[model samples]
Target: MKVFTYSEARQKLSTVLDLARSEEVIIKRRGGEVFKVMFKKATPSSPFDVPGVKTNATTKDILDAVHDSRARKLGI
Candidate 1:
């Protein structure tokens, strides 16, 4: 764990944050108040990142299915 006073933390804010990514960081106030900092994992942006079902399908099979669905026919 790393500890820094308010003045020190303010002076090296970037360094403090980089250290916080790996371990705990503490910031102390003159009045004896303390604060903790830690890294938070980022969330995925893609909706397809969700869990998938087991499948025996190949890439060609999947693309062929998509192509068939999009094909035009005279009789609808």
Candidate 2:
């Protein structure tokens, strides 16, 4: 990830876009605080593979698993 100031991104919009299409770039303010701009690799199934998400478990499934685990641990 690369951080670029607002002015730099504004002046080099084309280059920024090109870089963003290939890699992640962070656009920030003068104070070094980032407000916007996130980049990701180009892919077709990008939406399917998400981090920290369990596609196989629903709310009820999670509750059931928790209940089972708790019962086993507590002997209840």
Candidate 3:
């Protein structure tokens, strides 16, 4: 993913920090759109890859699945 444009990433900001350490630089602008620059993907902390936080469903399992989908759409 290498798009760049904002004046070619401000005139090659050090080759976009060395292609954002591996890959992912987008940037755009001279017309608008495009983005990504990197970083932001560090959450998973156990329960084997976070299967919905290893199935624990709290907050009363999201208000019991929003009160059982508003009591099955009112048909209680």
How many clashing pairs per prediction, in order? 0, 0, 0
lDDT of 3 by residue, 1-76 (tens): 8888888898998988678778989898966887778756678787687544456678898999999999999999
Off by over 4 Å in 1: 45-76
Q: What TM-score fits each model? A: 0.59, 0.43, 0.26
Candidates 1 and 3 compared: the better one by lDDT is: 1
Which candidate leads in TM-score? Answer: 1
The candidate, 1 or 2, that scores higher on TM-score is 1
Candidate 3 wrong stretches, greater than 4 Å = 1-5, 35-76
Each prediction's whole-model lDDT (CA): 0.91, 0.80, 0.83
User: Alpha-carbon error at 16 in model 1, in Å?
Assistant: 0.5
How far in Å is the alpha carbon of 49 misplaced in model 1? 7.2
What's the distance in Å from true for residue 37, model 3?
Answer: 9.4
- Residue clash pairs of candidate 2: none
Q: Mind giving the per-residue lDDT tens digits that candidate 1 earns over 1-76?
A: 9999999999999999999999999999999999998888777789877767889999999998877777744333
lDDT of 2 by residue, 1-76 (tens): 6678899999998888888776788898877688555565556577777657548888999899999999999999
TM-score of model 2 (CA atoms): 0.43
Clashing pairs in 1: none
Ranking by TM-score: 1, 2, 3
**Best-matching candidate per lDDT:** 1
Tell me the TM-score of model 1: 0.59
